[model samples]
Target: MIPGIIWRVLLIAIALVFAGVQLDREAGKTYPLAASVPEQFRSASQFPMAAMALDSDNPDYTLAEAERLIRRRPLPAEHLRILAQAQFAAGATDESALTIQYAAQRGWREPLAQETMARLAIDAGDMPEAARRYAALFLRRDTQDALLEELGPMVLSEPGGAGRQTLIEIVGGGDRWHNQFLRRGARVMPADAFVEIVSATVANGSRYDCDLLNQLERGLTTRDEAAGEGLKTVIADQCPS
Candidate 1:
């Protein structure tokens, strides 16, 4: 004879599982409505639509979706970041700033939030803040080359020699990005800036790699003869026989 309590528990579990499946089906049907339907008509299942909303060009749709997701799970840093970006794009500057503050507090290591704050810092002429953010981004393999393309010159031109000094510290410490930075710089950076960074790295007590210097010299020479001559002199000065 089956006990009543055991049968009740078994039935409840099966019911809950079926309910979850039903909810998922309903959410799937609602997902396509995210693009065309007004916010009020959207499904209660907001999570399914989050990705589509975030990718949309309309900030209003993104803002609504982010707000809904945040209400459901208030601590997700990604949701907060999307909310912050939507607010910023929608011209709600103060709201955006406050939301990013929350996002940062929740997930300081979140890359999207970091990039948002970094761009805001750049817009505000806060070079040191921008440099700090960019230095963090430089450590990310996927972002390094793109960042160098966009912000390398700005960092190279940082006033009072602080920027160059920062470069020296990174390369001098033999950070893995050191060689990649130099190799990529040979293509993206002004030849003068590239030469100065390499020269400073060697002068700062890091052992010079003659082969790397030779490669850099050849690359710069291919781009600009005068710059190549300049790097040749630096190579002679920094890498002795």
Candidate 2:
């Protein structure tokens, strides 16, 4: 019912609005998601670790907003994690995994991504994948040690007993992580895993197996020895040479 001139004017106005939106969207397709985040997150000094928490009652909505803004501009590693986590909480786990994979493919070197992948694998009931991902993270030079502790619960998902399976996986790396596992991880492990490690180490004939018992003599003499006693007798009696 409008006049032709008015109709033309309205169409032009709508076209201009659409063009503006397109421009905004193109601008946002890399860090500094200024459109979606507050000033603090945009700041170089406060972003990443110090940015605002994305915790929300409607995590799914939050994820959509993040994805929209990220399409306009890529957010930092921390922000990407928030996005992926929201996807996970919203039960969009497959999407969350792909989001993390995209970040990794984009060369994100943060351990948080790796840890998140492992957790996601756990949620999906993929325990061996979880273990493998955790192991990869552990071997990283700057890997967060807390990730190993976090592995405790996920390890419970492993078959052949969580403790034993985790220890087997850890020790399987031989020279690369064997001693590291013994010194940094073995003692505090679940009692069953410790027992399994000790048992395997004493029975090893390689004399250089990944198991910590291969070097039992040194262990028993340490002033700050591990708390487990089962390996003490095995080392003294079996590998006395």
Clash count for each candidate, listed in order shown: 0, 6
* Candidate 2 Cα deviation (angstroms), residue 230: 2.7
| lDDT (tens digit, per residue) of candidate 1 on 95-117 | 99989867855775667766766
Regions of candidate 1 where Cα sits further than 4 Å from its true position: 1-48, 56-61, 71-77, 89-91, 98-115, 144-147, 158-160
Task: Pull out the clashing pairs in model 1.
Answer: none
What is the lDDT of every predicted structure here?
0.69, 0.56
* Top-lDDT structure, candidate number: 1
The candidate maximizing TM-score is: 1
Task: Give the TM-scores of the predictions, in the order they appear.
Answer: 0.67, 0.47
Candidate 2 residue-wise lDDT at 87: 78
Candidate 2: C-alpha lDDT: 0.56
